[model samples]
Target: MKKSRILLSTALIMVLSASSVYAHPGRTDSNGGHTCRTNCTERWGLEYGEYHYHNGGSSSSNSSSTSKSSNSSSSVKKSGQSAKEIATQKAKKAQQEKEAAVKKAKQIKQAEKDGYADGLKDGYNGISNIGISKYQGAYNKGYKEGFAKGKLKLTNEKNKAYRAGYSAAQNGKSSVVPSIYQTNKALSDSYLQGFERFVIDVEKQKYYQMGYNDSFNMEKYIKPDFDNANHIRWYKEGFDAGKKKQAA
Candidate 1:
């Protein structure tokens, strides 16, 4: 009975050693796995060319699952980075737009100020409101108002000059502008205009009276030595009227 037990134990050891050799027949790969080559279906119950892991190594399916999980995590991380980049770009763009708006506002304000100043000066100088075409918006409005004011002021000054010249001429003074108006071309021209009108009126009256007296005395009609055509025309008309009245 003792010999039979020892023999049984030896047989058990041989069986275990043969099973260990058969289970790991070929060399393992980096993943502790290799393809089945010899006795694939009979020894290991695996198909030919099938890959399997050994010694607690992970299976290809498990590696695939882990790889998929890792890729998913990497993809999530990349997605988060992309989102952050987009937000940063949007913030930078908003700041740029705000700066541009402020710059535009300053330019507009400066333009408005320059336009008003130019308009005021041009209006006061009596220059034409050409700023209407040269400038826009508030400038044109200011130019028109200034032009009206300047024209009114010029008109008042001309009226005063005309009155002074008319009084001088009626008093038999020389047709000359006063010293005060000589410095101003507009006023000087207006004064000369008034003085000439009064002188012409007096000359015209004298010619009419002379023509009337000659017609009453039945003298021959003769043209006067007047340089003015209007004066000669007035004399002829008066002579004709006097002849008509005498005949009536």
Candidate 2:
């Protein structure tokens, strides 16, 4: 009986050892054994039974796809930023060009104004001096009439006036009688009256007449020789005539 009991105990130990070894790779439960493979479908309610078998490959493929998606997003962002930068640069360039054009236009307008002012000044000077060759004949006639009679009248006042007129004619200055007159269409009647009564002597009367005629009447006389000895005299006459017309 003692030997049978010992044998029975040895058999029980062997069966327990075999069961422990099988249960080593899984957890024991009343239903069955639950391994990582069975737990995936039973506990987690996975529809696919091959989940654990292909878990590593599926995870690796998903990671690769995610990485590719991230890279594509980054590329699109970079491309969009580059396009925006290009557009911004073009807008800035266009604004600068527009400003430059406006500045150039302003400069051109200022230049035109300056040119017009200069032209007006030159025209006024030309009218006052009558040194322009086109009017030289009238200037000469006035000078001859005033200076010749001035020789006969030895009085201080007459001589002084004659000398002044001669000097003015030589220097291409405006006549004393009309002063530096502006070229306006309407003549001053008072100025003409003042001129007629200004000088009284017979010799002075001829001088006055010469000056008046030359001042009011611009002759068709054109000088052939600009460098002639009488060029200044002719220009003086024309200047007087032009000056007189302002009050004619």
Candidate 3:
């Protein structure tokens, strides 16, 4: 009987220890929670010393809250990244546009410069046709200004050539256009016109003076060379006028 009683006592102690192992017996804190210390994995499926609730608290609710927080954080991060990407794109586009504008401006400047040079050359040479250009407006503006300047220069040069020809004729020099004006038809024509005017004036004055002197002295009429029809006509006209003056 004594041995059976001792055996029953041992069995009762074993049952109590087993129940304690599974029961998680501990004084509850203010939040009805405590750290797992016994059979943590087997009884609660948790790590040792991990905090958990046991007063009908739902772990799924806590898990859902944590998941929602993580999702919110992820969304914020994604939004920040998206905004940064947009800003980067905007900056890149702006830079490209700025570069393109600068390139266009440079092209316009170059076109104007080329047009001015071409227009100056053409105008100076008396050319009338203006060719095509990529930047037509800028090129046309430059061309107009250049053409005006070139035309003025040509006019001044032509006038200078005329004066030179007139002086040469007045000094009885050869009626030859200068080598400088030989290549330009306009200047050559101007020089020739001046030379002819001076020669005609001198011939008329000489014929008129000779007729007057002869008539006043009562000399016989001296005729001019008939090789030039103009000389003959001028001499005859002068002789008639001088005769009338003497009679009056």
Candidate 4:
């Protein structure tokens, strides 16, 4: 009873009694219509707000809850996307490195193949070119070129013979292999046919056969003329001279 009286006294002090009302923006005329003409929804919302404030009932905070949930969902999705992107980038980088390594390996293999000296020389003519002759002279300058080359080789062979003899001496050898050096193309071709004919004749000889098997490849070119009839004339003469000296 004492608490009730105290609450009543507090309400009586706070609540306004009947007094002269001020004529303001939202005031009504004698007819009770608002001067400012506030909207019905707006007035109803203000009345509802006043009722909530005074009653002190529990209020739902759904808007705040929905905003928080939306934010959390967005954050989760962003984090998941970041993880996937990072993984994808790593995979792509790894693939690039693998491809690069494969390319480097292929390049290395190709380089190794290119390193062979024999393969490097395939583009040029080889030792087999020794068989060619300056026989044809259909072109005007051809014969002159061949003649000039022959003359030059004849001159060079003198010097070559000295060198060959020296080199042969180092080997403690009595003979030279392919003893003539044909420095020029024409030099080789000058005695080409005569050399061929001499080789054919020597191969036919029984004594020459017992000495050396092949004839096309002679021991060396000799200055004393060679042909089919005189294949071993030089050799037999040399043998006879040696025998005479030994008997002496």
Candidate 5:
């Protein structure tokens, strides 16, 4: 009986160990894979690799899109600024052109006021400034020379012009003589009276040529009402009366 019990005990122990090995599904891999431990470790590693790849791909795509958007925004800003700059430049250029045109018009109007010939003489005064030195002396010289020349040129050019204007006016075309031209001559004559006196005092000598030329009809303007025959008759009467007194 004791021997029978021992055999039964040994058989029970062998069955328990064999059953534990066969029943455990975690002991070996199914589906022709490696051992359960090795397969599970490798599968987990593959899952980690896939996760990294997906994260990396998503990150890279997002980064690329973000970089492109930033670049586009910068380009848009640059293009807007470029347009603004171009518009600003155009505005400045237009303003400068307008100012220049206005200045030129003023100069032309001033030139026309003096007439064509006098305008030409004034241009030489501007050219002579290049050689002028000594502020006070040059200023005085330039002013005097420019004034004298301007007057002389105006007088010479206007002599025939005034005669022509007078003839035209007598012929009944009063509208032909510009008002500005008349005013210009009057202003010049007025300026000459003051300025010539000032210069004669300053220079202590006659700096300008005095006396009118032969063509100037001083008798016509200065002695318009004087009668030449009456003056001659009066002189003869006075001389005859003086001779009678001396003879008596």
Candidate 6:
């Protein structure tokens, strides 16, 4: 019985050894390249032509598979790199476009402010000059036509200034004033005085009509009768108030 047990133990040891070898089918060859172990191709059921072993234990088929795997890995890396570069370029381009849009908006707003400020100052100066030169005799029939034309001129200027102010405010550039507020205020004061005492009923109507046509936002004056001195004063006050408010 003891001899029979020893034989059974030897057979079990041989089975375990064969299993370990079969599980590990790879080994280094004489040429320092990887190859299948002896009898591995047959044990794994691989065809002889697909995994033929030479005397040096090298496998041509396995070497070709390793090369193909390496090439596939390299190609995947290259494709990933190209996609990343394209995404980076698109991000840069989008940023540049956003910056350009902001810059253009700023420039357009600045231009609008410049136009308004220049028109206000020039119009005020011209109106003041006309008041000094023409208001004394505007009641005469011969001078009435020229007086009407002069009011239209001043109305055009006021319209230009108000339109620009509105546009600048709308474009988010309201804080940047192209003209001096104090200068506008002082000019408005003089215009208010001239509008009160020198302007007659017909002239006031003409001015009010002109305001309704083009300068409604800048000047809102109603026609005043001879007895309503208070109404005339209100017209000047309204003009000054509108100017100061817009400039601010």
Candidates 3 and 5 compared by lDDT, better number: 3
Instruction: Give the better candidate number (1 or 2) by lDDT.
Output: 1
TM-score of 3: 0.55
TM-scores for all candidates? 0.47, 0.25, 0.55, 0.25, 0.21, 0.24
Give RMSD (Å) of candidate 3 vs. truth. Answer: 15.3
Q: How many clashes in each structure?
A: 0, 11, 0, 0, 0, 0
Q: Top model by lDDT, which number?
A: 3
How well is each residue in 58-101 modelled by candidate 3, as lDDT tens digits? 34557665455444423211112567789999999999999999
Candidate 3's C-alpha runs over 4 A off are 1-81, 208-248
For the record, the alpha-carbon RMSD of candidate 4 to the native fold, in angstroms, is: 23.1
Which candidate should be chosen as best, given TM-score against the real structure? 3
What TM-score does structure 6 among the candidates reach? Answer: 0.24
| Candidate order, lDDT descending | 3, 1, 6, 2, 5, 4
TM-score of 5: 0.21
Superior by lDDT: candidate 4 or candidate 6: 6
Question: Which candidate, 1 or 4, would have the higher TM-score against the true structure?
Answer: 1
In model 5, which runs have C-alpha deviations exceeding 4 angstroms?
A: 1-134, 179-248
lDDT of 2 by residue, 1-248 (tens): 99999999999999887554334334433323222444444544333222122122123546776455444423211112567789999999999999999987666555544444433443423322222223344444443343444433323434344455455444555544443222321122223333433432333444445544555555543433446334445455655666756756
Question: By TM-score, how accurate is candidate 2?
Answer: 0.25
Model 4 per-residue lDDT tens digits across residues 7-112: 9988776553311122223543332322222332353333211111111222255556544543442321111256778999999999999999998766655444
| lDDT digits (tens) for residues 113-133 of candidate 5 | 334333345533333222332
lDDT scores in order: 0.71, 0.45, 0.75, 0.41, 0.43, 0.48
Runs in model 2 lying further than 4 Å from the true structure: 1-81, 127-248
Of the two candidates 4 and 5, the one with more favorable lDDT, higher being better, is 5
